[model samples]
Target: MEIYALYGPSGTGKSTSALALAHKYNINAIIDDGLLIYQGKKVAGQSAKYEKTTVQAVKRAIFFWEEHADAVKEAINHYPIERLLVLGTSRKMIHRIQGALALPEIHHYINIEEIRSSAEIKAALFDRGTQGRHVIPIPRIQVEQDFIHRLIAKVDKIFSPKKEEIGETTIVHPQFQTGKIHVSELAMKKIAIQSCEHLPFIESFRKVKVDITNTPVVEVDASFIIHLGQNVNDLANTIQQHIYDAFLEFMDLEVEQIRIVVSHIQIESPAHA
Candidate 1:
């Protein structure tokens, strides 16, 4: 197998840039953060981000567990992996992964600095340090199905140099991120209430419930008293979006579902009143 390694410090955008580099080299598979991603889908191995602690996360990344290493190796053998791209924080880390999986030595090494500018690296680091954002080079659904992390957004389209869409990437806040705040459901309800009030058509919320049972994946149930005039469908969608944006902005938690029900409709528009 022809193996290539992309090495960089944590939060330097290695994972973010993995697809572009893979496209450049026509690499069909990528080993990132202890996950085996093939053709933009996670086929095998667990993500290190799923680990509860940083130490455990690092161990997972380096395939410290025997079962983890065996699973990834078995997947590699099953697939026609002629060329592979492995992402790590250093060449030694790449070597560690190679040793764990019993893969061939890296034929090429690409540093994150080569593909990204210094300014870009700084911005990535800032996002990681402040917002605790991590990028996984796979579709959002892939992460959502297997991971229990705060999903920020899914970049559906990643264009290559030829303007051809390469693949999807998901942004997430892992459980082990430092300085992760704990916001009460009441605070989330307040945000949802404020979101409803911002809409001119929404008079009041009859009920606002924030379900945090799933932790990062929250569900919001909001019943609003809306004014009559505008289309109710448009109004409901606007309320949902507003509340979703509010949670993402104020609390940094992505509300998975924002259920909006028009409990009552006022006779006149708020503007007319």
Candidate 2:
């Protein structure tokens, strides 16, 4: 089925526009994460953010989407009685999604203008707008500045926020674990999962859980294995790389020694992620 993706920074009204269009088109339902109801059935949303509640929301939307996809294609002669639409971030992402679904091009709805103004950002944050879904930090794009600057502008509202409170700051307990410490395997595992927020492939990161009872070492279930757009080998390497990157962030330790524990690949995004 073709997706008229509504991609924009935090509160670009993607969901609203999707619904309005759906109504105007007389199509069955809205296909993103919210306002999902068509013909008394629900639709599915994206699943990159794997929180239980959020996943349930996406799955709910997906069911409705899958159920209505074909009907949508057949019922609405013009889909809009005027036009059809597809939405998402860069044309690159939208195009990728189009090919994946064998969908025709969207009528085209690109709105980076919302991202250019911080005023818009604030409104989106409070209004519960579409919110960024590309889900990658600025520096993470691995692209040249001009392009990176533009992309970052579009998705800056979503990032791994720094931890801070009041004027008082607490220490991060142990800096390093060399000889032996009370760091439980479960603790380390928990740390890894928590840190996944700091990198890309947030969805894929869910598959592997960590265990530490194995002594100064740790057991990891790293299986990031889907390179949407990147060097296949490089993509594999990145999954491990970003995990370790997140692992270190979670460690929050100022240790001199380093231990790299890699298990397997789970899910993979493109190189830019």
In candidate 2, how many clashes are counted? 27
What is the lDDT for 265 in model 1?
66
lDDT of 1 at 272: 63
Each candidate: how many clashes?
Answer: 0, 27
Candidate 2 segments exceeding 4 Å error? 1-5, 24-29, 33-40, 43-85, 112-121, 126-273
TM-score of each: 0.65, 0.29
Q: Look at candidate 2 and tell me the lDDT of residue 202.
A: 32
Across residues 74-180, which tens digit of lDDT does each residue of candidate 2 receive? 44333333333444435555554445434565764546454233333333332232213222111222212212212222312221124321111111111111122
How does residue 85 of candidate 1 score in lDDT?
A: 98
Q: Write the per-residue lDDT of candidate 1 for residues 147-234, one digit (tens) a residue.
A: 7656554454677999999998888878888674455668767888877676666666667777643223333344445556557788
Instruction: Indicate the TM-score of model 2.
Output: 0.29
For model 2, what is the error of residue 192's alpha carbon versus the real structure, in angstroms, after optimal superposition? 43
